[model samples]
Target: MFQNLAPAAVDPILSVAEAFRADPRPHKLDLGVGVYRDANGNTPVMTAVRYAEQQLAQTQTSKSYVGLGGNMRFSRVVTQLILGNAEPTGWFTMQTPGASGGLRLLADLIAASRPNATVWISDPSYVNHAPIMRAAGLRVASYPYLDVASGGLRREAFFEAVAGLGQDDVLLLHGCCHNPSGVDLEIDDWQQLASMVSQQGFLPFVDLAYQGFGDGLEQDAAGLRLLADASEEMLVVYSCSKHFGLYRERTGAALVKSAGSKQVQGKLFELARRSYTMPPDHGAEVVAMIIESAELTALWHSELYAMRQRVQSTRHQLADALSTNGMEAEYLCHHKGMFSMLPLSEASIARLRDDAAIYIVAGGRINLAGLAPNKIDTLAEAIVRLAA
Candidate 1:
């Protein structure tokens, strides 16, 4: 039975991380993985998270299952965080292992509801979006997004693609801090997309992984809320990994907004029951505690704000360093999140890895959060020397 089994395809992102670990260079730089690091190159737990864990340790009593929907309190808090003042009558939320699991669960629901439906993603979307959707037996297609030449949105081409979407299409979008590219849609752009989505009748599916890492918690969620306000039915997959520092906890949610929310919720619960059964409750409980308490929520917000500012500062530092080296990289400052794609070819990316000990993911994505400020000049020099 094992003889005919084929080798699994290597994950593009994880393989880069593995290669980074194997490299023997003492001065190697890893900007491949999309995790936030401080000035000392550490992914420290936030004060709020640590405090929440302590409180959970003292107050929590049992390890009983949290049922298929996981923590309803967590779901409610996350919904409020995402939708803000939107009416909650037609909304449903369920916990998942993480955004990845949430993505798969929702994909399964889409497949079950409409097997022929096509899920449209950004041309250069999150690496796993298409694979997960397709794994659930859904057709995946791409719409225009980033304009490589300008390091900005392909506005005209994007809208042109959106114009063709109809009832059978599910448009997947990055809520904020677009992965790999870091280019984000402005509020005006979201407004236009909402109008187009309302008129075109395609279901809007949003993946919000880096909510507070972009501008602020409220600012990052603005576009999603705008889209939510206009649409009667929508799908959202949210992650607490980035903002709540719950990466290992796999804390996330799948949210549905429809007139028949009860039916959709039942479908999601059934899908989830067949899979992981129930999401781990530890992280969700911790998040619920943090969000429920006003004091802890304030602390979390402050920490999130600091992380956002640090990433932004790193972007500016890199841009300034590149500018001083006579490279035009002002576009870096305009990018919203932890990632920004440098225009390097395959050969250049390999050269960066081989000659300079700099590990960047394929497609030139560098995690500004992973880069330390003191090493900015070295990175800028390498890019200028090797890119030319």
Candidate 2:
């Protein structure tokens, strides 16, 4: 059995991370993985998370299983955080290992419910989206997304593809900050999508991994809520890895909105049971403690705000540096969250790594948060030289 197995394909993102780790260059830059890093080049745990853990360690008594749905309190608070004051009558939420887990769970749900449904994603979406959906036996396809040269959405092609979707389709959208490209859909785009989804009957599936990293928490969730308001049936996957800084803990949830909430809830539990059975509770409990307490919640909000500002500041610094180096990169400032695709060719990307010791993932995506402030000029210079 082992001898018959084929060699595994290297992961595009993780392989870049591994190569960066193996390189001995002291001034090497890593813009491959999507994790957030501070100006000091650290992914520091938030103060609120620290306090919550301390409280849990002292007061909590049990390490018992959190069941198939994990912590209900965490699900409720996070749902409220995502939906705001929107009516919650048709929603059913359950904890998963992370947004990745939530994605798979919902993919399985879609496969179970509508076996022939075609799950349509952006042309260049999160690297794992298509594979996960396909693994769950759902057909995967792409719609036109980014115009690489301009670093903007391909608005006409996008709406054209969306216009064709119907009842047998599932439109998977990034809730706020789009991964890899960082070009998000504006509110008007979401509004238009809501109208089309309502009229065309395609189910809206949103993956919200970097909620607070784009805009404010509420602001980032606006499009998702708008779509939710318009569609009677929807699917959502939420992650605490970014905003709550719970990356290693794998805390997140899968949410479904349908008139048949009871049936959806049962199906989610059944799917979860055959998979992980229960999501890890430590991170969810920490999140619950923070959200439930006023003081901790405020502290978390402030810390998240500072992180968002830092990413935005880095974006501006990089753009300015690129301009000074005789390259126009104003689009860097316009892209949201931690990532933006530089319009670099494959040869340019390879030259960036081999000649400049800069590690960017394939497709020219750079993590703005991963770059230290002092290295912005270095990156800008490398990019300018390579492009020239």
Candidate 3:
């Protein structure tokens, strides 16, 4: 049995992390993974989360489970955060291991309900998206997204891809702060997508991982809300890892919206029962407490706002430095979120790693939030050398 096991390929992002950690260089920088880091390169727990945890530690009575659907309070709170004021007719929400788990769970549901459905992902999407969908036995398709050569989105190609979607297809979209490629849609583009969904009869699967990390929380959900209004059926995967700094806590939710008669909530509950039975309670309860308290909620908002501003500032600084160094990287300034794709080839990325001790995904996707502002010039110089 051991002899029959095949070797697995190392995940590109995790491989970058491993290489970055092993490097002995004094100034090595890692731009892999979308974990948010402060200006000092520290991933700090938000004050709100800390307060909630303290409260739970002091007054918690039991370590009992939260049941198949996890904490309903947490589910409602997360749902409200994603949907905002707009209330869809029939919607279902469930606590998941994480956004990754939520995505897989929804994929499983899609496989169960519509075995013939295809999941259309962005060409240069989060590396895990396609794999997760395919693992569920769903056919995967690609839509043109980032044009690395010119450092911009191929809007016409993207529109054509969306326009060609079939009724049994699900278009997977990055709600905000698109992973890998930080390129996000404008209001007009989202509106166009909503119209396409309405006309094409396809479902939208919105992945909302970095909500507050992108634009404002409310602004980030704009596209998802628009799609909810336009499309009768949708799937949303929400993650708390970045916004709440709860990476290891494994917290998130899977949301589904369908017709009133579909009993989607019951189906989601059954699915949760068969899968994990129940999600971990600590993180979800912590989030619920924070959301329930006005003061804690405000504090959470403040910290999230500061984090977003820091990432934005870093992006501007990086773009300016790259531009001054004669590199075409203005897209960094325009894109929102924790990650952005650099206009670098595989050879250029390798050169940066081998020669400059810099690490980024092979496709040049980098975590803009991971940069220390003071070191932006150094990173910019390395990129300029390799890209030039």
Among residues 3 or more apart in sequence or in different chains, the pairs in candidate 3 whose N, CA or C atoms overlap within 3 Å are none
Query: Could you estimate the TM-score for every candidate?
Result: 0.98, 0.99, 0.96
Candidate 2 lDDT over residue span 1-388, tens digit each: 6998999978999999999999999989999998888888999999999999999999999988778999999999989988985558799999999999999999999999999999999979999999899999999999999998898999999999999999999999999889989999999999999999889999999999999999899899999999999998999999999898899999999999999999999999999999999999999999999999999999999999999999999999999999999999899888899899988888999999999999998888899989999999999999999856
The digit string of per-residue lDDT tens for model 1 on 1-388 reads 7999899988889999999999999999999988889999999999999999999999898988889999999999999899994557689999999999999999999999999999999979899999999999999999999999999999999989999999999999999999979999999999998999889899999999999899888999999999998998999999999898889999999999899988998898889889999999999999999999999999998999999999999999999999999998999999998899999998999998999999998899999999999889999999989877
- List ranges where model 2 is wrong by over 4 Å: none
Rank order by lDDT, top first? 2, 1, 3
As a whole number from 0 to 100, the lDDT of residue 21 in candidate 3 is 91
Candidate 3: list runs displaced more than 4 Å.
260-262
- Judged by whole-model lDDT over C-alpha atoms, candidate 1 comes out at 0.93
lDDT of 3 at 48: 97
Per-residue lDDT over 200-246 for candidate 3, one digit per residue giving the tens place of the 0 to 100 score:
89989999999988779999998888888898888999999999999
Q: How many residue-pair clashes does candidate 3 contain?
A: 0
